[model samples]
Target chain A: MASNWEEFYSSHPQPANLSKNEDLLRDFTARHLNGDTRVVLVTSGGTTVPLEHNTVRFVDNFSAGTRGSASTEYFLDHGYAVVFMHRVKSLQPFSRHFTGQKFLNMLDLIETKDGTSVTVTSENIPKIADVLRKYKSALANGKLLELSFTTVYEYLWLLRSACQILAPLKEKCILYLAAAVSDFYIPPNEMSVHKIASTKPQTISLQLVPKILAPLVSLWVPNAFVVSFKLETNKDLLIDKAREALNKYKHKLVIANMLQNYRQKVTLVTQQSSYVIELTTEQSRIGEEIEMYIVKNIVDKHEEFIADRSGRS
Target chain B: MASNWEEFYSSHPQPANLSKNEDLLRDFTARHLNGDTRVVLVTSGGTTVPLEHNTVRFVDNFSAGTRGSASTEYFLDHGYAVVFMHRVKSLQPFSRHFTGQKFLNMLDLIETKDGTSVTVTSENIPKIADVLRKYKSALANGKLLELSFTTVYEYLWLLRSACQILAPLKEKCILYLAAAVSDFYIPPNEMSVHKIASTKPQTISLQLVPKILAPLVSLWVPNAFVVSFKLETNKDLLIDKAREALNKYKHKLVIANMLQNYRQKVTLVTQQSSYVIELTTEQSRIGEEIEMYIVKNIVDKHEEFIADRSGRS
Candidate 1:
């Protein structure tokens, strides 16, 4: 509805933090290019579209980054170096375990005549210890790099930079695009500089956000195994739309999900065949995530892809 | 632009959590009605408007609830019962100090041959101890009641219920409505049940959210000391808009602040005159907040109003 992706880059100013994050991405990619362990860039959470220049209000998506955050941990468990790019304030890999108010329940405050102190309750120590150990292990091994963005502009800019950095690894890299990106945005030229006063009925015009996956697949990180997602409210449209994305973008696979029961099941749509990785009733009830199976499937396929590329070469 | 506030309520279904939260409000207010101390209902954070029926997206405001959360602690310090109704996931009292990634840095993980354990490192214990003590004291005394809402519809419904429950307190109650409420929203008929397709340019019509303060001040809790807020990106409109709101709503005070330096300063506007409360350069450098002085001023005004009424009777 407005400009092409390149024009969008030229017109909009680069995010102030882009250069700093780019440096981090470059360093992270450099370290992970050991050829022994494959690296994956997993994008999580949702990008916002600010309606105003001085943004007091913006459009947001309802992803808590559960799929991405949970998936990052599973990917790490499989010994993959993960560059976890997420929306600011959304869930992260390890911290996601205890971010809610229930975190307060874990700590016991002690009072004494001398002063005060805080200790993890005897009952709660095991869970905290487990998460903390894994988090520290990830940091010590330098296997995880975390980056965050809030707006669509920042996300796109950072995504491009990350892709360029990871492209050197060729088929050894995997690009997992899971962030719930905005489909529409108010163009920079049309956005309000001040708060839109609420004096009367207002009409807002939104332009179609340029499809970044097209360029992301073909131009950026072309050799990487690209897996995109399609989430729909209507069950009938889910697989068809996912297949459409796979055909159009020419990516490795499409993960199709319905908004109603995304956690319980996800369909993997590929060029040759499409199949589902579903959680059994017991597995779901006992707190088993579908991500464990999804990651296993992807790791297996990625192995085949790398071997196939080597065989062809 | 749409129907009146009453009509809006009748048309929209009540939030599922309303009755549960109402019980909390009733119990909290009943316990605080001992004639020993006053109570304040402090609404914080920002209300959202869902864009679709099955909401993958919504409109959100940019308030981390720094003001409301900080003020809740100060109000608790002053021995006033506090009802902290806020937007879900926004910052809250005590916990706001350490919700970020730095929370991880506070603990040291010890891995030994026996097993693994975690502890609060010596350096970090002091700060966490202080916050934990205060948080426990408030909870133990039953002085703070926390409630949360996401949508504007839920916010309005909850506000009315809280007001009805607090009306019995008369002049002893204060309603500090500081939440960054949305000014406009889409009607039910206009919103898409599924995600809005982004193949073309789209037009979204937003109707003005009816001014609930009109009914709130005149009918909801007429005897309570009510305070509202006006935040402006433009400096020139700040004071004028605050005064306009006071004249229209006939509330006790309006806190006016420029978006740029809201943390550093704010103007307290009443019918008689306006005065500024600002943090000194020394205070600002050491991370002193302006809410301390603002809450002090409001407490003074509330005390005087209570005394005046007592004398008249």
Candidate 2:
């Protein structure tokens, strides 16, 4: 049998930067608590399972961190403090809008007598300015805290530390787990110390990674309204799997999505009901992202959850 | 025993875009051939082995495509027309220097009563201009042609198509195989049609990928000076493994490096001798990339090879 999450953590060494990141999170959370702010931890991107300690190769999930990054901005717009934990070099909130060759395409290099200068092209200035204004304001107000991780080990360590810090806030916090974490991994004790050589036929055996949600929901931040994502390629199985996860973890909700149409549609699965949200063809053509709708719905639910808890107390 | 390269290609389906890319390559090659230009096909990044047809997850080699992208620029500087074949979204020649959050950091957004505008900061303008100028010139002069692939299947199909297009050029063509291709893969026939469900423990079986260099050197573009890279984490076996590859493939050179030190140093292995080339710490600190030296050495060897061929004829 595979080790459970607790055993996995005890056996594996904590990431070297975990303590430093925890300290940063502590300060950020403390500041928010004093102001009676609502906080959301948005975990994004894909976690990699390294095959070796020296790691020349890894098992990776397909994710651009589009969902998490996009949702973080919307959360901030709704006046929620966000802990943006994401894969390093994956899309980031403001930077996501300008990544790849898009940034270069948006700029015009002008040459004058003195020298050359690069500026956003006239047609692109409005959109860039809008994103930049929101980004700068978030930073200035310290409402957004950014942290990054690469390997699965680092992500697990940082997640636990973040949860530990958020525990005191209880019902005031929401755990929006959007990251596509690895399902299997070669444990630290089994991974190669060096790169696996290509000189011979190789068999790599990876064990199922213990489900972190087990500890996360049950112990780490028990009172936090936790929402997890369940992505499947089969439409028929999507809602069923999501509902199963919600039942097992006893979390607030599970966002179900089919891999093919995730960008345009998703289903919100709760214990009592499941609702589908989709973007119309016209809306997609006009560049309205599905994340906007998803975030809005989530915010409403989170608010209702807070109200219910406060009434009971 | 594993199947040879020829058998593997015969059994596999051709990448959907292979024929389209071949048309582009054919046209590009004809133009260069008429101009008497030396052409280098630089393969960059890492090919992925998808677990399913929908590809929610993959086994990926750890590479940012730095070696291939940086070297392409140097090759271009030395007046070689380049066919830059790379993994989708991996680094590319001029654009690489500005990727990630670097582009955002190098700019400033200014607001006025009229509107807001973004411009490259004065300190960063010159460097950005130089890179942009070179990138524009390359595209304008038809000196660079790019083709991108994601899966190992696409890489194999495109690679063979590219070689067929370059075959008529013979010795004037150089194959700089820098992409970190997978040594093992789950064939199309075996891959799941949808995403693999994480409902239970699953064991994936992968077969060794046939060595492409064998057919590449002996059949496709036989007269091209082919150089391959051998990346290993073990230092003691690096040179020996590189030499072994050279002997087996009958290729011109193998550039060997330890994964940890690859950015700073590489060992050039040829049939007669091997030589180590390394960058000084000061050079590295000053932002000098080792690709410049590697490309220079390869260019020198290529010239010698051309001369020797002419003498023999």
Candidate 3:
């Protein structure tokens, strides 16, 4: 046991891979020191799964990071310090000019079927589910975004940890929860040691894991501004889902979208009213509109809070 | 007669929004006069039909132009002269460091559909078909790539002229025939002034114009190194289509891909063998592989021909 512990201690494991985004973050932070640099946290690309070998497993998503990364630059030009948390293997390298954490682990999990109502202790369930469902076509096409995770437990762990890490920083950040996460994962009892051949009889159950980060918005980080996304196929359900998400996370804003045509079509659902931004008519301008809308809204909300605090003082 | 010609020219004047990309190209051309510099042309994004006052008639591909634009930077780094001809809304801004042509008029094809056949008369047919087929899923989901031409003759005339303009520069060009061109266009007799609606009549007869570029490839530009792409639904049919394309265009290489999971997977079909590049494995690394393969092959081919000429001398 002592030798085992010694071996663990003696073998110098490589330090964590440093992010290339540090320089970019430093420069951005430096620029915002004196200004009301609208700080926007944009997460781009698909999460990566590390395999047994140093290589990767499977990946999903085809974001190209165009919408997110390009919007970051646009936001910066419009005087915003963007904290871009990116997934690995995106087409454009995240400007190594910013400050952000890149969580490079595939979160895997195993859950009972939804009907069974099995209890799960995992975190960030909805976020992971959101990531998976929202980017369904992008994931299916296998274009720019790719992802791989063996189990749901690992995925939940990664998801919760990432949100938690960023949760504390939420005080100054506008959380753009755009990353899609998976809702279903393999159940612990049903998981196979090796690849399960079709010959094997296996019954898999999926249960909704309690959300790990949504509650945190109201419970732990009440001062932080939150914005979540709702992707639905039914138009009627979109606004309701967005409201549910907003109320649940207590977010200031929610972008709800029905599975519309691929041109970045979404409806902005705020506490006051709802607005739809159609990409069908203006496909090329979708990214610009989304980025501008999010940035302006966040900045405006932040300013109002600041003014309110000043007034009280 | 002179007044009529002037009136015609004034009525159909070219749009003057081509300066930014043109200037970049001029500056890029001027930068590398040392002869040690190599050039790479990157054409990206998609173009659309300008229609509405607030909105425009748009036709676009799934082509974010990521592959082409990203690889251009790589080529420029290795020292090469690039004349990039691009459509509207490309992924990257025409690199300020390269020679570029931002032509809004790529290939204007007037297409009408028969029971199972599509007739196109313009050179842009192939590109249009390619984009539509590439974004098949998105189309099914609702966002469609639509094109409307005033006349089939107009489309044919534009295509012919565009090819003629670029023919002389074929010697210095490495044509990356990534754009999907249509196989057929409508004939004059079949033309009609009806907007294609979602609910259509039971029957329609359409006459197809034979592919114009195929004949031009063999007759006009015999020395150019042309590469074409072949997309198929069946694995067995891929090589057959590839061979047909090669024979038709007399191209040196063809990238054959199947519509089955093709958005995520593709094969590099050359004269010798077919290589499948699994996009699921490495994200950014896959982009690297594509760049290396294209660049190395071009460089080697150029060097080999030069060596052969020297040996003959």
TM-score of chain A of 2: 0.96
Best-performing candidate as measured by lDDT: 2
Q: Give the top-scoring candidate (TM-score).
A: 1
- Write candidate 2's Cα lDDT for B185-272 as tens digits: 8868888999887766666777889889988899998999999999998888888899999889899999999888899999999999
**Of 1 and 3, which scores higher on lDDT?**
1
Docking level for model 1? medium
RMSD of every candidate to native, in Å, equals: 1.7, 1.9, 21.9
Per-prediction DockQ: 0.72, 0.62, 0.01
Query: Which stretches of model 3 miss by more than 4 angstroms?
Result: A1-41, A44-83, A86-161, A164-174, A178-224, A228-250, A254-313, B1-81, B86-162, B168-174, B178-224, B229-241, B255-313
Off by over 4 Å in 1: A1-3, A112-116, B1-3, B112-115
Error of 3 at A160 (Å): 5.4
- TM-score against truth, every candidate: 0.97, 0.96, 0.37
Residue A303, model 1, lDDT: 98
Q: Each model's C-alpha lDDT?
A: 0.88, 0.89, 0.42
Task: Name the candidate, 1 or 2, with the larger DockQ value.
Answer: 1
Candidate 2: share of reference interface contacts reproduced? 0.63
Q: What share of the true interface contacts does candidate 3 keep?
A: 0.00
